[model samples]
Target: MVGLNRLSLIATLGAVSAQFQKPLLSQLDDVLLETDKTGDKPLVDTESLQAHISTESLFEHANALYELAKSSEQEFGHPTRVIGSEGHRRTLEYVAAKIDSLGDYYKSSTQAFPAVMGQVFQSRLVLGHSVPESASPMSLTPPTTGKEPVYGNLVLVDNEGCGASDYPDKLKGEIAFIKRGTCPFGTKSDFAGRAGAIAAVVFNSNPDGLSGTLGTPTPYHVPTFGLSGKDAEPIVEKLKAGEVVDSIAFIDSVVNTINTTNIIAQTVEGDQENCVMLGAHSDSVGEGPGINDDGSGSLTLLEVATHLTKFSVKNCVRFAWWAGEEEGLLGSDYYVASLPEEENKKIRLFMDYDMMGSPNFAYQVYNATNVANPTGSEQLRNLYVDWYESKGLNYTFIPFDGRSDYDAFIRNGIPGGGIATGAEGIKTEEEEAMFGGKAGDWYDPCYHQLCDDVGNVNATAWLVNTQLVAHSVATFAASFEGFPERETTKAAGVYEKDTLYHGRYLVR
Candidate 1:
């Protein structure tokens, strides 16, 4: 199949005609000849794939993907490719078409899963007689507007309403005013719900305007809203002054369950039982185009996948672009959960590429080999370290807390490793010394904002990371001699680890 060119097909036809003693080619009504139009492109393998990857090719593909995102925005009216949106659907289609084009080299497959489309909420929190203001609803916030507002005596709870014990008995039938920190939103909501609270308000401890997803959906909580600590401080002071602090929370939201896709493809060669998987989130946050956030990651995978068609691999190299990573790794979680235990065992490693092209970048690798310390993670760690060392480039390890799509893979005990440039986190002076960028600036100043469009991309970071990704793909595709293989699983369910759902912040 590697050498199945047009001339070879013609030669095959001649042989068939000679064997049958008839001119089968002449009798055929429709043309049946297919060709390896790749011409002299090297057959796909570690060395060949590495050799074929060029900056120009990767940049061209990146530009096209950015254009696709812009086109989706122009057509869909949403700035982002959030799951189930026009941008996202079109993005998947674009990637799928590219994968299909490589049908000659790989066996493409998709794992369809149900996703809860993000909710539409018209919510307000009316404190006392003040007119209601737009309350930042937690991500995956449930709808609750039953013709009557939720009325309760709002009482104060400790900072980081992290545990049930934090809610006093007075919270029964009252609204719990908790501060956000230390725990997932679900934990706070669950504690408040169990304490008989009718609603929960989680105000941020930081001055930064508070608003984010509830991590994931939960059934044990009432309607919850997040507030900026700056806005809520006055209320906390009022309550501390022995005020009653009456409040009403109203939430009207419509939820939809949508069918989304995960794009997957693997080389036709190599052992099926052992696979090296590279993944990136194809969807973006609701905030903006997210070109640098993940457009960089997805396009990197696309360019690598495209070049992979040039040569054959020794071990199967599988490429995946997940749909809903911004919504707390939904696509990856579903894909990993749906796999049978036997099939799950087939994955040797999962390496993620996300936000690798942050404008103010740091070459960060997931610290899976250390803190998370899953099996065989060190090999992946060394791959990046050695590569960076050879280039005299600085690289550091970010905690592998499953803040991205790798959450699902590591939960199932797959040895997970990956790289990220940076996100909303500020880059410090120490980092500046190593990576040589300005100190005290956001790694991606436009992390999830409207400006995260094509113009926001860091071309140098994108090119460097894409090449490294290609090298990893090629290295793993060639052999797993030093990589760790997965251990047998005892049970198959929603695999849970202590991985932080969104950030490295732990919740217990």
Candidate 2:
């Protein structure tokens, strides 16, 4: 009844608005004419689509997304486009508006679902009398707020706190101070708890404040918090010098189910049975405005989709702005699971784009040539490799370690590949020589932090990756000439689960 009433209301509003405005269908003809380079609509080609990608348009959309995320904090008290937040809703609206502007050229809709999300309202870490402003709680870690804040003398854990031996006997009934590296956050938290520590504080190896996770909830975990390198340095020094550092760690976090939507759009003029899909997670972590982590990828797809409106395609091209990615790739996982088997066969390939403009960037393509990759994945990988080699650009291979939106596709026997600049992984001296970025620094220092704002992105790297994305979309949409067919059963491949969960990369 509510749905019917909403539809009726929409109809009434449409009728009222029709009096002052031209019908959308009527305006589409004029829009089409404006988009056409020739007098007639030409078959979509690689060069024509590539020509449409511009730094001006990319940044224009990027800036809009960034501003929307910023405004979300003021309007809704959430500083990010996290799933189910108003910021995410506004982001969906932005994408929908862009698709709507195409006016019948594409079909679009929102895929709504419920997800359990852990929201941290407050995470405070106090060392002696000094409180660190960069302190935050790891998502899914046990919370200590509302109860007495865990108070104890801090014991510096030797090494990276991945092993039980690292937690000294002195950690018993104390707070364990450990550096963030080698194994998942959960590993350290569990070790700290087992060592009888009241709480665990993990500091980043990089200068940025760490916004991370324990992968998932565990009974062995204790209240855990993160601190930036600079903030933790003094505490570390005091503890190493055999000085007793009194500390308090508090976290107020809760997990609850919330409704979220994924925005999906596809061309109407192509063979739907053979579709080429491209996706990027639209949701951000709860830490900050996720403009670069995925805003770059999401906006890149949006810009490409806008340009594709000017031409026709042989295979349908679908663009998805996925939600709930930071909360364990929930949106894409749901999408793939809910898709019917016959509809699943329609997807020729899946390409994902995430964090394209990391400050210290690299041209890293998915390593689909590895034995663990599903059938047809290698060919898709070759497209990116060939594109880079053709342009005489330096490139490297990134593992398909179930890190991004591509996880669902490959697990379902669908061939998938994409590109990323880099994330929390440190840049080596070799990468420094190749990419001309600082060695021993994070590719994205602001990865999953409050600093992942407008200034965090590298515009030059973003533009290059955006063009590469456009090139792939045009190539597959034109023809899947050399692409292999997906198998009937789930693809046989070992998905190497890396220590990198979401944007946080653990050393192990």
* Top-TM-score candidate index: 1
Please report, in order, the local distance difference test score of every candidate based on alpha carbons: 0.75, 0.82
Q: What would the per-residue lDDT of candidate 1 be over residues 1-508, giving only the tens digit for each residue? A: 4454445556767545476634554443223222223333333444456566666766676666666666566555657777877777778888889889876678888888887656644777887776435367676666664724788889898767886778999998888898878677778888888888888888878665566565445566777888777778888889989899899987776456788889898877777888999899888876677788788888889888887776656678889998777766778888888888888888888898888788888999877663445577777888899998988889988877668888777777777788989987889888999987778999988887878987777778888888889889888776788666577753533345554355322232
| Pairs clashing within candidate 2 | 182-507
Query: Best candidate, lDDT-wise?
Result: 2
What is the per-residue lDDT of model 2 for residues 225-341, given as tens digits with 9 covering 90 to 100? 878999998888888888888988877777677889889999887788999999998988888888898898999999999999888787899999999888888789889889888
Give lDDT: candidate 2, residue 389.
93
TM-score of each: 0.81, 0.73
| Native-to-model Cα distance after best TM-score fit, residue 402 in candidate 2, in Å | 2.1
